[model samples]
Target: MGDERGMTRMLLECSLSDKLCVVREQQYEVIIVPTLLVGIFLILLGVILWLFIRGQRGQDRRPAVRGTAPTPPSRALSGEGAGHGENVCVPLKETSVESFLRATTPDLAKLQVPREQISEDLEKIHNGSCGAIYRAKLNTGDPAKSKSVVLKTLKEPAGLQEVQDFLGRIQFYQHLGKHRNLVQLEGCCTERLPLYMVLEDVAQGDLLSFLWTCRRDVMTMDGLLYDLTEKQVYHIGKQVLLALEFLQEKHLFHGDVAARNIVIQSDLTAKLCGLGLAYEIHARGAISPTRAVPLKWLAPERLLLRPAGIKGDVYGAPPYPEVPPTSILQHLQRGKTMKRPSSCTQTMYSIMKSCWRWNEDNRPSPRELYLRLEAAAKTADDKAVLQVPELVVPELYAAVAGITVESLSYNYSVL
Candidate 1:
């Protein structure tokens, strides 16, 4: 009986030991799982905080780049009725590029100008908008018919630099005053809604029309001073050169000198009209491609994606092709290409060639062109005289009905 009792006691001890081992294992598993879960949660929270901080810092840097459209005060009060008083001035819709060009008075005009200066003449021109231009009469010492003037009002939207440019032009005119080649600003009034500038009215209009007329029809001698003669062309070329020289002497660049910006008076005197596109020599180096000016009449360095320097004017030139006699004959033939003329109008062709050289550096400076033209004007022996042969530029001839090289005869009487 004693032996059996001892065995039962041993068995009981074994069962208790097993239970203790199983309990220890379960406790260890529970503790490890909780620690791992806590570690994962801490990592996720840290990542979220880092992303939030970085996003906020980015937002603070460039507010404009964040896709937020700035609301102008003008747009906010649009369509709010006639009951609004004069004191409650609201902003207008964002000024467009076209309206800026055509409008006689722009919205910015109000910001800079005072109320008293506003006049009926200040109404917008219904044209493209780059700036506001006002037409006013100037005291030319004759009260009977006061000389008409054009005033360009410049007000920048958000760009302070552009405003500075407008101011600089004002100073430029204020100091230099008027020149025949320049559009004369008789006076300026920046007091209120419509800034005032008094400038000569170019009744003859812009340069583009002049070029087109010359290209299409035979210019009337009553209005034109020069014919298609090389000497005449050379003289005209010289006049342009002199204008360019005057600008260069002042250390200014007419950055945009295309056919469109030039204006011809009744006397056939050409004036460079648009000063808004003009830039000082100092700013040329840093001028962005966005502001690099247009492609027409541009130096190749300015055209071919090359870096433009002060020496840029000396490089990249456009190649000018003269009216080919074959082109003339083709016109005569109702638009069929003809044989290239041997050498009749070579001088005239040469002028075009020089004007259109590929390298600006190789191109003649205005001074050089002026000198050449002046020389050609005086001397019969001038090798530069282009003889418009019976077969002139055929391409030009082919384009026009009833026009041919044979149809054109140089009559000194016309001159």
Candidate 2:
């Protein structure tokens, strides 16, 4: 009886100790378990917050304009373009020659050119780079009914390569068709001797002709076509800039942009013509330096014969306009005859300098040049007219180039 009582008492004490241990474990579990979970959640939340903040900052610095052909990453691709630019990449559609050609210009096969005999007669009247440029006969050669038309007769050795070049020009015009400052391509011809690249003829003629015949110092005061006012040049530049903007937006480059290629309409608007050298950007990741290029108005990188690209116009020599950006005017001030116009605007010169840089990395594209010109023109509030002699004045164009002002000795027959 005593042994049983002892055993029961021992059992009671052991059970009480076990209950105490259980109570301690429940308290610890409630406190430490909740703390561990909260710590883990806080760490996760901090990580998520960091990611969100970084993403927002990236979006802020990105370029607002889309469709800008992406260039290759420089070491400096640290910005939005390089960093978190576009996460959802769009696949580039493969473009064929036929598809690209069809998309850009009118059907080349349909247009008709003038005969060689007629072209030869016009060639007798005028001859230059590609031989003669003639005033085409109406209804006979021209399809687009307009005031006047000039048929560019491509001479013999106008082989398949020449035909390809002609096709290229038409393609460029077709895509860049119908801007107020862009010349219209009436049609083309391959039929009946002498291949022709026919286009709308501006009665007022080209900017070169206008400047030659109009400015007071360039021409006789009485023979001035339009005063050599800053306003006029500004207007010309403004119109040209607009067309350039359009071209740049389309990622097309006008390889030959000079006074001769600019046609002035009766309404004083300037149109861009002769797009035989325009190129399109196919690669989007970056512009490679292995592309074919022309040298004359090309940027330095292009002159080095590197791959040609958009904004390469910046590297080209200055055009005829007496703007800043080129050293041509400065060279003229030094009394020297440069191969090309280098001065138009300081910004323009810089842009061209960048465009014509020996290294493709250094050159700017035509689109960049267009933007620079537009911004520069916008900030220029000074509309003050600088004094320049009339078109009749002797040596008026000495201040500029590509001008030969003279008195009208005979009636200008528009016919």
Candidate 3:
């Protein structure tokens, strides 16, 4: 009877301390749910923020002009390409030849000129290090209108890297859009190993050859006089400057700027060529020591293998424009300078002197140089052809032009 009475009392009476414990338990349950929800939300927000930051960094890695081929990475991959005082663009890198072909196949298909349509002239083929440059005629599929194109092709049995490097140059051309003063990339044949980069033929050959011809008597080719005047030099020079400005705007500097690189049409349309070094520095961040760019033409920085400089030109046609960049530095350091011709007026000479300054910073910017050229052009006499005293003989001409007399291909009549 006593035990039953105690149990009934325990069941009926609730202590204030016990009630407080039950309320604490309910508070913990409510607090735990809200805390867990808040933690999950914070984690989700952090993940979203991290993704956004990653996406932004990806966008920042792209090249300046969006070229067709991505060669390799150096300054461009780190997003550090910006803030270069006169730098125009930052080029990116690529993975493999297969991937490059896969990415470029769709676009390259349109650019591929049918090899069947291109008639290769065996006699005019100029073999290069990796391939032969052919003066071929593209049929345009139309027998009536055969387009003359220069075919820069890779030799068969080429390895992967050689093919990629060739394609990189093609992509570099695509990177450099259409500019009047620059040679135009008409089409290409990059479907397989024997890749052909088709460039529009500037029939006048190179500017140095044209100048050498001018040194002799005024010759008639295609019923037109191929002569150069002071005014014409400015005209050609201004055009070349426009090309340089175009490159400068893209953050590329033509390390070797001279007459040999510029090709003039009969109408005096000077198109700049030999951009292999420019593309090399643009893609690789350094010039190849084995390149053909003249030593006297390059700044001291490029000579010492230091960081390349901006702003670089022509005159009494450089005595030895063939001296490669490797040897030119010492020639430059020893204070050997090119002759300042009478027709190569003081203004233009000033520009040349400014470019040859030992210090890179001391050189004029491309814009400043262009401005000076334009100012000088305003006063130039476009009609009077500048006459340079003829070299005593053809051998002297060959020596000055850096070519052997045996290699000179004169027309049948001239011969």
Steric overlap count per candidate? 49, 56, 4
Regions more than 4 Å wrong, model 2: 1-131, 140-146, 157-168, 216-219, 279-296, 319-415
**Candidate 1 residues 44-130, lDDT tens each?**
999999999999998567322111222222221121232232332222323442244334234234223332332334323212122
Instruction: Work out the TM-score per prediction.
Output: 0.51, 0.48, 0.65
Ranking by TM-score: 3, 1, 2
lDDT per residue (tens digit) for residues 1-415 in model 3: 9999997787556465677557867899999999999999999999999999999988777534322222112222222332232432543332354466676667667677776787744324344445556676788767889977777765443344566788888888988889988988988877643467899888777776677666655533333366666667767877887887788788887876776668778788999987887899778987786775444454566556666645443212254454543465566667676667676777767777776666666776766766777787788777776666545365664555554554333221132
For residue 43, model 3's alpha carbon misses the true position, in angstroms, by 38
| Regions of candidate 3 where Cα sits further than 4 Å from its true position | 1-104, 120-125, 219-224, 312-317, 320-336, 392-415
Q: Report the candidate with higher lDDT, 1 versus 2.
A: 2
TM-score quality measure for candidate 3: 0.65
Number of clashing pairs, model 3? 4
> In model 2, what is the error at residue 214, expressed in angstroms?
3.2
Lowest lDDT sum, 10 consecutive residues, model 1, at 406-415
